[model samples]
Target chain A: MSELTPLNAIGEFALINRLQAGLTLRQPGSVLGIGDDAAIIRPTAGTELVMTTDLLVEGIHFDLSFCPLRHLGYKAVAVNVSDVAAMNALPTQLVVALSVGPRFTVEAVEELYAGLRLACEAYNVDLVGGDTTASRGGLTLAITVLGEAPTGKAVRRSGGKPTDLLCVSGDLGGAFLGLQVLEREKQAFMADPETQPELANYEYVVQRQLRPEARLDIVHELRELGVHPTSMIDVSDGLASEVLHLCAASGTGARVFSEFLPLANPTLEAAAEFNLDPITCALNGGEDYELLFTVPVTDHEKIKNHPDITILGHLTGKEEGTNLITKAGQPVPLKAQGWTSF
Target chain B: MSELTPLNAIGEFALINRLQAGLTLRQPGSVLGIGDDAAIIRPTAGTELVMTTDLLVEGIHFDLSFCPLRHLGYKAVAVNVSDVAAMNALPTQLVVALSVGPRFTVEAVEELYAGLRLACEAYNVDLVGGDTTASRGGLTLAITVLGEAPTGKAVRRSGGKPTDLLCVSGDLGGAFLGLQVLEREKQAFMADPETQPELANYEYVVQRQLRPEARLDIVHELRELGVHPTSMIDVSDGLASEVLHLCAASGTGARVFSEFLPLANPTLEAAAEFNLDPITCALNGGEDYELLFTVPVTDHEKIKNHPDITILGHLTGKEEGTNLITKAGQPVPLKAQGWTSF
Candidate 1:
């Protein structure tokens, strides 16, 4: 019970003013940031601009009952930045449009913005402009991130060649497993209000679910190691789905080695506890925010020793079809059981 | 009733495929469009990139009962484009993110996208990227527009000076009056379903409300006339509000002559029919999507004879305060009763 000001009391202008007061423009290209009809930025010459947008609807993409507003805000920006990284680009700026419900107080909005600002700082991106309005149903966040890559340097999903080594950054299945843990806790709490849910044991997995970071570090490291991914896409829709996307875009097929699929220890332990297959989770669990990419076979040696990079498989001709080779030496057609909002 | 396919029937990816099938990328700088994690574009050298985003929530921004889905889609793009035009920039691309509800069908989404494509063609801005997801409540659209202006050529609201002649493109009060008429008709229809709405006489105003176009033509005309506006803003939230915005941004005051305010005859007639003051409607009516700007006194002759342009008044020192010179020879302080979503 603390005194809190409702958003309606101060009006839209004052709310905007409060939200923008702490923003500091640090991007060199940002000529004008906020406080205008539009934001102005000067994109550097000889660089291609990479842009992506993502929309997260309440009750569809997240459940506020268990999800913190700050984490929601962070995830929104991180997901967009992940898209930027998928293009082999460095995110420079972002514009967020939010539709907040009447139930949200000024303090709640401030908390959300604080997370957004923190993500901006972490990603080295500036908050350029956005629009905020009232929502009749639930809160919605739509974020558009602007990034830059040197001319002819952007790695597209269509660039993978046959026999290219497919690689993935960091471990997978943790986020999806983390979500399961959170949902279970939520259900348990609902059944008995006095019961305190135990989440400390699932800290690593839960954090992965709540505050997944974009794999910008992998993008930077690849560049530093003199390696450019032949094809790239962020793993937002599970490894199996993303592998298929890269293959389809490149007019090829892929053979993913089940043994090589990276799964965190916590993810495996949680999968066993839940009576789920860790390998299945690794293949089809989404929201890892990791980079799934392909590199020419000749450059594989340069990336093989990298602790964060895992070589998962190789591309094949179209006739070969997309398949996941089991540890038992059987080939099964890869199925894309990615999340469907519908 | 005709058979229709629900959105969930085809799922998110297939629906996206259907919607993007007809999109043709016409921008030279567009290196990538859709189907990837992010879109890529090569911004022209030495030009500032102008970015803006707007969120339109159903029930909050529009009434689905009367507002056609097609017009909602069109207005979403046009309003974002209007912001780019206000910055004195040419809109080059847009990314639209939409959250639809379960009630939407594949055909309904197609209709919405058809309208979006039509607006993209009309505005000559490429549809580069977007996100599509499901919502639990009403449909929501968040659009981000990217435009470009030559270095140091983008106009800002803070550049106005004292004695600058304020001008507006097209007539005002029509859109607001149109909303009023639509609401009245809706009430009447609710009262008696058998009675049809008598909207033939209010067609012009109704169209203004339903499909208001952004004044990009005025931006081009001013450029062609060799007149760079000292300050400019789109009249999205009424004349009084926008006038006050320019004043506050520029640290100056403004005098808007009530007699010189642009009002369509149809709007005036509608106001009389509703027993409302025409002048008040002209001053407080929002969503005209027209351009309100100021030009140096020396360039007045170049724009005075333009058929769509109307010179209202002039800016004054901050101490003079923003006011409207009444037809009765008395000046009244301008009030910003702008639309508040809160």
Candidate 2:
């Protein structure tokens, strides 16, 4: 790293000028981007826009001790993009408002923005505009993402029907297990300054925690497969929680089978190492950033052999209630024990 | 306030449910609103959308000792709406992200949302979606406003040409003056706990600081009068700073007359009380949220007699430089002494 430039030395306007250097609007609808009072976007003639916002506050959402600024920045963008994917929309533009404490330097802020830029490129979204201000506490990021979907094509959380197959992309529980590993390492370091983290065996789980990617690929693939989800939501608050959300919004019930949960080898091993039940971890752990949706029973054939997706359950009549069927054939009510900032 | 219920007691989801109560989508284009992964908006035909974001951090952009949460919320929306108005658009929707410390009660958060809802109703904008989370510091607000404008009617900051008349809506400097009064009262109260603030005589200026409205009405009036501004910007960072921005963006220069600045009676009186030059305050004090623009000389006849509009000066060649012409006929180079969070 070069010598750090104090944020105040260059002032807000100069820092903004430096941050915006070499930036280009890649989205065709982005008529005007940064350096204006507001960004202008020419909406596609037959498209509806989806908007979402997420806030990440230091000491609440992430710890500076282990969470690198760059990865945090990427996660901030990916989370909002995940919401857009849940709506079956393709992200187009984003505006980030960042508040940094006095301890931050201009170079440090640049590194954060660099990660944001990388995610924007990966998601094919344009960095339209943003606000930068000073915070009395630690770093805070508020990101708002705008995505576009063809007229009447965006999915909603309230459109599910009885017997619809509830499916989820990728595996779950890895991110939460990964956080456990990181927490253990941090504790070891605090107990002895010379302690080093042994993460070689937990690489996959660690990556899931530190740099989760939005499951936008599934959205595109589903479109190509001609399988429109009846109801959809991102797995931001664990599978059990999101399943409940889908059921509540759709005014239906669900039956999730413990034996059918898609669990990665890494996540299973980490859960065993932590002496935690793999099924419980899969059901209640959060932050996987995977897409969860329900499709008509007839559409299941198209996605049955899809390697990255899993059929976890099916929607049922509202009177049936939401439950998880165990291997022993016992039905236990599902609960949402997802992460809560409060 | 009712019995102070702690934020954690209700949990994040319940808190969200409480906050979103009775929030109806008034905009015809708002297809979906809160309680979903993302909000959906169907853009009006042949219109472009404008977007902007602003962040307000406690102890940096505001002092809660003299600022109410409701007023702070209103100001946050107004500031972002001001940016949209600068683009000559009508605001359509808004998304707010709030982070509150443990000290904030559920009732307090409700108060803040009340103000936000009031602003949404006032602007005829929909409260689409938002994220609420815990903060380690005081309250922080990040607001993003979305507005709509006709296909090619949205104004930009780079259209000013030499000799275009510089125009501004309403008076300036009252917000800054109001802040000074508040700070003074806070100090006196700190020295003597029972000392009451002497704000009766400074009600107008005090209100300016506490709750400044965005000049969207002027944008509508300009359109109705058929006077299209060649270039426009909101007077957020004072008249001089915005003039410099217009000049820099348009590759022109400007000459502002000291005597032509519109000053409200309360602002003038407050300036005298603080022993600050009225011209200096109007040229440098920020947060007025008024519109600053330039129009072709031919359109001057349309707005010349408008009660709220004032013609300050005119654009000049780049070589002439941006200057404030004093009543004594001396040209003093303009400088941007706007607020800097750093």
lDDT (Cα atoms) of all candidates against the true structure: 0.92, 0.93
Where's the lowest-lDDT run of ten residues in candidate 2 chain A? Answer: A18-27
Look at candidate 1 and tell me the lDDT of residue A188: 93
DockQ for each candidate?
Answer: 0.92, 0.94
Candidate 2, residues B98-168: lDDT per residue as tens digits? 99999999999999998899888888889999999999889999999999999888999999999999999
Off by over 4 Å in 2: none
Task: Rate residue B253 of model 1 by lDDT.
Answer: 94
TM-score of 2: 0.99
lDDT of 2 by residue, A10-129 (tens): 999999998888467899999999998999999988899999999999999998888888898889999999999999999999999999999999988998988898899889999999
Model number with the top lDDT: 2
- Name every residue pair that clashes in candidate 2: none
